[model samples]
Target: MPVPCIILASPRLRKTRWPRLVVVALFFVTNCMWAKGPAPATRIPLDPLGFQPPLAQFMLAGSSMLTVDYVDSDHLLLTYSTKKLLKRLSDCPPADQDRVVDGVLLELPSGKVLARTSWRTHDHGQYLWNLGRGRFMLRIRNTLTTFAPMVNLAKGDAFAQRPFIRTERRIGGVLLSPDADLMILETMDPRPSDQVLGDQPREEDKPVQINFFRLISLNGADIDVHASGALRSRVTGRIPANSAGYIAILDDGRQHWSFDFRSYGGKIKELAAFDSTCRPSPMLVSRSEFIAFGCHLSHTPQILGAFNLRGEEMWEQTMTENYVSPSFSYAPGSGRFAMSRVLTRSSLVDSDSFSPDMFGGQEITVYQTDSGRQLLHVDAAPIARAGQNFSLSPDGLSLAVVRSDALEVYRLPELTKEERKAVQMAEASAPQIDGDPSMVLSSGNGDSTGSPERSDPSTPPAGTREQPAPAAADASSSSASVAGSTPTPPAPVADAGPKAEAQTSSTSASQQAPAEQKPSDIQGDATPDQPRRPPTLYAPGEKHGNDPAHRDDPR
Candidate 1:
């Protein structure tokens, strides 16, 4: 009461009070803004870490294009032709069309050229197969000859070449074992009696001959080839690690034949035969298992089965609707399998060929290798090119899909501790060779171990000398170095929580069943009662249908 009676308010006092109030207000506003932080970035930058750079820019004059492969976490294998002899065959003679070419193994993320070799071939290389442990096989052909040259990837030396069984016949198909130690070649034999009926010759009338060969040694000086007799049906794939031999789908002049392979003792044993009303797709072989997709002639569901080396059906999944040519990747050590199929509104004009623009979109389904349980299912954009268009990384931790303009990278669902341990142990115990490891070409400081100290702008010269290094130890060291040097991934977005939970839920549902459960307990049991979901499809130039759902998905 006494203080109120004074009522003394001077102009200075009033001005000071307003100034203090304004300052307090300004401080509160500043603190609020700071606490909220800058608005999060709308999109993450396309960091080069754990991704392949756009390689089209690297193409040189007269060069076709670069074909890229994720060799491992640390390296990328790139093969490309500097000249196109076949394309200009009419103008340039075969002799004049001598193609100058090589393969480059590059360190990832940094895109540093690690190793380059001119040992590929002067002839056209039709295919490249990665045989684990720094080795690759190139199928090369020219006007006169077709042969497969095995290259010691570490040495960058295509030391051995196994020519086709018959020079006259064209190669129908080539399949390599997981380790690339064995090869299966198929050739088409056109019978004289089967005359050309139309513009396109009758494929069924022409019989296919098969041959199996083993690469005994891959020395630059001496190479040995162990060839087997021709089989009736086409040789589909090799039985992984079964130096005993290769697998073939028999063609006994019938609609269905036994799935068999030549034993190491050179004897054919039947795995399982298809029914008369059913036809099977090409067989996919892993180290210990083989899988094939089969469909009945009637309106029945398609069947996908995984079989052991002993020919026992481990598990099966049924596809209710038809799908266009799908891609599959399997990781044996981790027991993970991924299947990608294209969906369309109407039937595909051609099921054998994948037309990226024709399909609506594609769906990738990840499943347990043994249980056939679906781990994760997501939609993806259409592919960019043909042939091994989809790749699962060696560790089964990432999947690289080649889209039209970019290589889209996706993170696979995480593996359980046991699964990861199993993969690591398998890799650790894998067979490794002793003695001088092949030299590598690096842009870094070099001593004669194939590491080039380059000062020129041109491609580094091929390594000439072989250096003494433990193969396994070198691989381990390089991997560790690259991993440590790789750039850190971008910080996670604030909204990643719910999406991650969804992935976890899906993964958990897949792993709910025991991994070692019998085939009967898991086969066709995971989603037997669920309503059929519309097939995920990808078509070129068209926007993906379910954008919001997959916008936050892992990639």
Candidate 2:
């Protein structure tokens, strides 16, 4: 059965003379208004699970989460976030886990943190896959380097990094292809010195550059750098510091690009660069065509755009409201792309930049890829928000959105016209074998043997009686019924007339001959009684010895 919807209606307020009475009534109504939707499929944690309730069910610890990928049909990979705690302790607490504070690649099934090689600093994370050899291979990148790591969660197992020749100045985006043969990494202004700074460093001049890309092969560890002509930026030589561009991998394995304007259009030279986190996901369309979308913090207004592979402009899709720290994914079977938009409003007193305000927007918008039209929009205000990233199901039927506290699975409706047609065709062609058939049994008038009439809810109910039909009864009365059915031999002929007596005896003897030749048809070892033949009837004059009924009565 489908889950039932929960709706709570507000109660009416009556005019009262007593202030205490009114207060009490209002309080009662307020508590009742706390009704919520059904519990989510499961409860995976945003951080640790000890003091935290299942993030999917309730909002006690201020969490909102969504589904990512399914472990099977029941379990899921959920991405969630909450208010960061200011307190830290040197010694580990009993409930809280002592996580290794380093850039590491970890798998979900087993909590294994990969070791780093040569103190490689990580600014961005890419794809992760379990090699089925108790190790996980992940793609990590920084402004200057991109590398792959084979991490063994087990203590003794060694984690190794395989470096490829082509390194990006800025490795902003990473996508692992479905086939696991190739990965796409987006590159821009590469800062090789971000990781080289000591405890105290000297100031350096800002660099100006355009954005380009590279596609790396996991099988051969080869890189295909984008053509020189592909280097283009929304801002010519120097894009605003807060501005960002994204890369997407379509289902067909094609790569695409887009620009985000979170940093461009303000009095501030940079869009609060540190707090700004923009991670873009590549949804592969085919081997060649894909869609990539992200938010850009710019000196001007922020916007979302899509770039096709042939270097053609498809469309610039943007939200009406201001949103930053955007994450997106293309769902599997659904054919709809979902975007998680985190809206941050700046304080009136602080015009410096966009920061966390009392009121903001967190929404999941799904769009049709074919025409790029909006399909569904869901927003959870005050309760949930998402930042950084989110994931889609393998089949693309559902989307897992990250909330401030937990994850939420937005089950997209079947929207494709073709899919709807197919569903309709299947349902129309399905056999209705239980429906009425001509000449079949009908349950009425004491003789029909069909289904019962529809129950009348208005009528008083009583026990129902069932009886055999006339046709069935007639079929059971005669042995001729066996003629068309199985054949049973007639009992031995009794006192055959003299003219046919010899022929009849010959026939009986002939039948007995075959029976005698066939070693008792019963399989396995037979019981002693099975070997014996029937007793013979006595002749009228031969019955004299122990016949009590005849001896006592003189007939």
Best by lDDT: 1
**TM-scores of the models, in the order given:** 0.48, 0.37
- lDDT, candidate 1, 1-555, per-residue tens: 010111232334355656766766776675665543222111112223232332331111101233445667555565544542433444342333245455666554555655555433432323455554444445444211222222344455433333322333545455555444555554544323333322334333333333445445444422233443223221111122234433444333245544554333323344665442433433444554566655556422267777655556667766665554454565555667667765554553333343344445566666655556565554543332222445556666655554444444555557777656644544553333221100101111111112123231111233411111111101012100111122222111111122346445443332222121111100010133432111100010111111111111111
- Runs of candidate 2 with Cα error greater than 4 angstroms are 1-39, 47-319, 332-334, 344-353, 371-386, 414-555
Evaluated at residue 433, the lDDT of candidate 2 is: 23
Alpha-carbon lDDT, every model? 0.39, 0.30
Question: Which portions of model 1 miss their true places by more than 4 Å?
Answer: 1-67, 78-104, 113-126, 142-168, 189-207, 216-224, 232-242, 245-277, 280-284, 296-301, 309-312, 351-357, 373-385, 413-555
Candidate 1 positional error at 331, Å: 3.3
What's the distance in Å from true for residue 218, model 1? 5.5
RMSD of 2: 38.0
